[model samples]
Target: DAGVTQSPTHLIKTRGQQVTLRCSPKSGHDTVSWYQQALGQGPQFIFQYYEEEERQRGNFPDRFSGHQFPNYSSELNVNALLLGDSALYLCASTAGGKGHAPAKNIQYFGAGTRLSVL
Candidate 1:
């Protein structure tokens, strides 16, 4: 079975351009979250979506947005991108619900898309 997958593993854009990143969750995963990782920095949560609704969001600006489909796949869209936006965009997937192992509750990340804004 294929695990989580992301498309166009790398992207480039001008400071004012926009970009879209895609992700398909792992088998049986019901939750998807987006994260941004700057060079040499740990991943920072962007937002999370469950049951097709945004369940939580991080400190990112309005330029960072996401959508989850009924099938649990998700997309991240950034508009009016800035040069500082250059970084790795990560997508994480995990099964939903409680009663799972604390360790099992951790999100599994995809290889991530490296975005470069010039």
Candidate 2:
């Protein structure tokens, strides 16, 4: 079975442009989450989706939006992009089953799509 997959491993864009990144969830995963990782910085959670609906969101602005398909695949869209938006866009997937173990619910991130905003 395939792990999480992301398209356009790398992306380049100018300020104010928009971009969309895609991801395929891991086998049997029902939850998809997105993160932004800047160079020398840890990833910041963007949002998470389950059952084709957004379940939770982080501190990102409204410009950062996402969608999840019935198949559990997902897409992250950034609008009116800013230079600071440049970073590695990571896609994570997990079953999120009922469990008390944090480790068990852990989301695994993929190689990520590097975005460069000029």
RMSD of each: 1.3, 1.5
Model 2 lDDT-worst window of ten:
96-105
**Using alpha carbons, what is the TM-score of model 1?**
0.94
Model 1 regions lying over 4 Å from their true place: 98-104
Give the residue spans of candidate 2 off by over 4 A: 97-104
lDDT of 1 by residue, 1-118 (tens): 8888997799989989989999999888889999999999999999999998899999999998889998889999999999999999999998865348775477888999999999
TM-scores, all models, native as reference: 0.94, 0.94
For candidate 2, write residues 1-118 as lDDT tens digits: 9999999999999999999999998888888999999999999999999898999999999999999998889999999999999999999998874345675478988899999999
